[model samples]
Target: MMDVPSIKDFQWKTLAPLPSRRVYCSLVEAGGQVYAIGGCDDNGVPMDCFEVYSPEANQWNSLPPMPTARAGVAVATLGKRIMVIGGVGANQTPLKIVEMYNIDEGKWKKRNSLREASMGISVTAKDYRIYAAGGMGGDLRPHNYMQHYDMLKDIWVSLATMPTPRYAATSFLRGTKIYVLGGRQSKYAVNAFEVFDIETRSWTKFPNIPSKRAFSSFVCAENNIFSLGGLRQGRLYRQPKFMKNVDVFDIEQGGWMKIERSFFLKKRRADFISGYLKGRIVVAGGLGNQPTVLESAEAFHPGKNKWESLPPMPTPRCACSNIVVKNCLLAVGGVNQGLSDAVEALCVSDS
Candidate 1:
């Protein structure tokens, strides 16, 4: 018996599409700019295209193509350089190659590769070092091994292994700790949550995510971590169901709290792009019911504990790389029908 709140005023706007269509691209926001890295083309072939977009100039500028053509890459921004790690390669094989692009140099330089080939790696950058974690290897089993890349030493130092093995997990840095949340293990979706403390150099187990789901997008805002919509795997021969369940992990409360059902997302989906904007959790573009791709978008206001509908994206697609810029949520290349060159941003304003 609660009422939903309105967004007040918000809108979706189209930006310069990628020079070419791509999917599974790696996206990140650094210094108020958004970067879209390697992905696959319309033919499902891996691509080497690299590009950057500026919201102020409202144009995309090209960057040197990566040394390797791959998709599903783990990308992180370290200062002025962008690091691209493990991904599926051109020959349809998992790769351990690592490369870094220096914004000043305007070119990419090969770095120390991973010790083992992997895909679906979860990565985060902190204190000028990259922490690379859980992903699927050639054996097809998720690896719990966690490693940190030392930019100065030009090597990867093995750290504490994850308590749970999985791929496609979401990671974010708060203070000196990196929190890794829900992913998939084989056919089952993982709901485990854990954190790694850099100063202590150890892993601590947190409460297992109550909702058994994977590929759910999570973001940090207002000192609370929010895990949004994803898919729950079902019985054999049955389709995996999309979920609108929203769980807020209050760092202060030290436990997970479920938001009201009325505050759930407007649509059920997984593998969608999400970001925190102006105190709202914004989710857009992903897989939904009837074997369909969704363009529908929505947001949740934690203060009001209410849901607001957002203007749908121009192209409905899954696996789109996403990041939050200064005042906008940018959704980069993803697949809709086929590969999409579309680049769009969900705009937020104080007015």
Candidate 2:
């Protein structure tokens, strides 16, 4: 893979902000258009507001709101339809309701709800099938249930349960296997790394993450899975400690790589935006040890084995709903003193 270019190759564009402030929203790109789905308002009440952004016009348009108001909904795009799954509803309760919005139809359709009401569920879709993994149920417990939605049958079919019961886990689909790693069981972080084979309908446990952290991000870059910065916790420390550690799992080698401290992020952050961009591992915006939210952005060059500083986010904020569309990484509504309507994109130049 080619090494990422310098900061000169990157540019941040401020786009039209959301119609209203929102946090915990879900953003998904379909047919080149970005959709910002349900999230909480400034009052922290769940909302059903739905909006779409057109890159060509650089504007946002309102769409039919979801039937159920929620936040932290798991979303996946299937063709032109966007699936909105379980999340926290009114009174801060977990919901099992599932809804779908068809861009062509311009309306919302109710689908099969989950067997259990839960929040923070992780969802992944491929080959006309949607696989929903771990979630925190209404009883305030994490569930290991694995269910897939069958479009033809219009029902949710239960699959083999994941060995680890945790919420907000990171899942990656490569070929026919879905790699599940690092989630939370209540407030504690889980280091479980597991993969499930679709055809075989079974799971294989892999090596646990070298570091146990809360709010860490896991991204797949080429053949390696990068576990980026997060907050480390222990009784030894007065409070949760922010980490700058980077651990990589080589798929072919079937084990973790010995990365030096120089390969880690320059800033210690958690709950940040991270992805593989143009052969570089990119990270931006999150809560750090600082007194305020982080705006610092950095990219790691695998070839040089060094981290390079990039242009900082114009509106530094945390807990933003983020998605990568084409070559741009969009950071949607997030907290900045209050709920923010900032919609910004970090675009990489082809040159």
> Which numbered prediction scores highest in lDDT against the true structure?
2
Q: Which ten residues in a row have the lowest lDDT in candidate 1?
A: 1-10
lDDT of each: 0.85, 0.91
User: Model 1 clash pairs?
Assistant: none
Per-residue accuracy of model 2 over 1-351 as CA lDDT, tens digit each: 565666788889999999999999988899999998889998999999999999999999999899999999999988989999999997899999999998999999999889999898989898999999999998889999989999778899999999999999999999999999999998899999999888898989999999999889998988899999999976555777899999999999999999888888999999888877787778889999854699999988888787899999999988998988888889998988898999998888887
For residue 120, model 1's alpha carbon misses the true position, in angstroms, by: 1.5
Query: Whole-model lDDT, candidate 1?
Result: 0.85
TM-score of 2: 0.98
* Candidate 2, poorest ten consecutive residues by summed lDDT: 232-241
Model 1 per-residue lDDT at 339 = 76
Off by over 4 Å in 2: 1-3, 234-238
Model 1 lDDT tens row, 183-269: 888767888999999999999999988888767888887678887788877787887788888888989887988667876787889
